[model samples]
Target: MSDKKRRQRLVQWPRVALTTGGVVLAAAATTFVVRTGDAASITADSGATPTRTVVAIPGPRTSTPPPAPVTVTVPGLPVETPVRVTPPGAAAAPLAQVQVNSAEIVYTVAGNQRPDDPVTITYADEAGALRTVENVSLPWRLTVIPTVPVNYVTASSNGSQLNCWITDAHGATVAASTDNTISATCNR
Candidate 1:
């Protein structure tokens, strides 16, 4: 064949393929519309009247709008300043002049016990908290400041004749206990 005839045949093949592809796509789209209940159909017979069919067209699609952005604000704290006031007739007192009624508590444990005998000392500290000293030798002494109303000292020993004493800040014995076998307690 001639070159010009061969070229014309090649161009005609492309046109034919494009037309077939367009027809197939149109048919597929129509089938999808019928299957999804989006198409209208009508029927008629050779000797009967044509029938009109109505299809419910859907409304415009709508979606809920997204919520607005939220913002929160916190107020800043107010500034505070210390204030001092004096009595109408009395002068202002300095902070150092303020006195606290603190007392010294002396816990002493002594007896005719042997030097090798160990003892246990239990007492309340200034803040009314119990403290324990385990395996302590005889002639045990502990001094503390008493801030609570009640203070106590207890001693336990396996030695013979254990005596305990609790002295106040005035060098006076407030509580004393003596035990010949195991334990001695002093409370004030």
Candidate 2:
């Protein structure tokens, strides 16, 4: 071959190689973008077909599951006490029929004590906590559903002729006090 023809062929070979390499790089980039879901849509060569859309659906999140309900039975008791457990955004089950180690007691404080002359009344609550109610009017009645075994109430006044009584659910008198003294206590 001639010198000029050989030189021309060498220059033309590099151009051809560069053009092919550029096309290959472009095709690789397009494939990468489609696989990674970076492109929203892609069109066919003929432009006659509908554009294809790409979507990415996320998987479920990694989280700890909710705790289950627990039931605890007390010794010597026929009923079982349930420990309430509820998950997030869930309605808890209603605690019905929880009648273990509990009873209904009625407390009455009726006397000749006038309404203007109120007395201090102290009672043991369902949790065995002493709750004092001062300046209470006469003929005060309280029905306490005690969680403990026993309950009591006391009415205190200065020569008020007070009367106090504690009764059970069956209207049986557990304790009574009808003294016209400084304090009258009824315990059961």
Q: Return the top candidate by TM-score.
A: 2
Q: What lDDT tens digits, residue by residue, belong to model 2 across residues 92-164? A: 3558853322367778787778546769999999888999999988778888888887688999986677878
For candidate 2, what is the TM-score?
Answer: 0.44
Model 2 C-alpha lDDT versus the unseen true structure: 0.67
Model 1 / residue 177 / CA error / Å: 1.1
Please, what are the lDDT tens digits per residue for candidate 1 over residues 1-188?
Answer: 99999999998999999999999999999899886553222212232333333222211111322232233322222333323332111224556765433477677776666666678889898898999998787667777877777788888877556777776654456776755557888887
> What lDDT score is found at residue 6 in candidate 1?
98
Model 2: CA > 4 A from native = 1-102
Residue 117, candidate 2: C-alpha displacement in angstroms? 2.2
Clashing residue pairs in candidate 1 (N, C-alpha, C atoms within 3 angstroms)? none
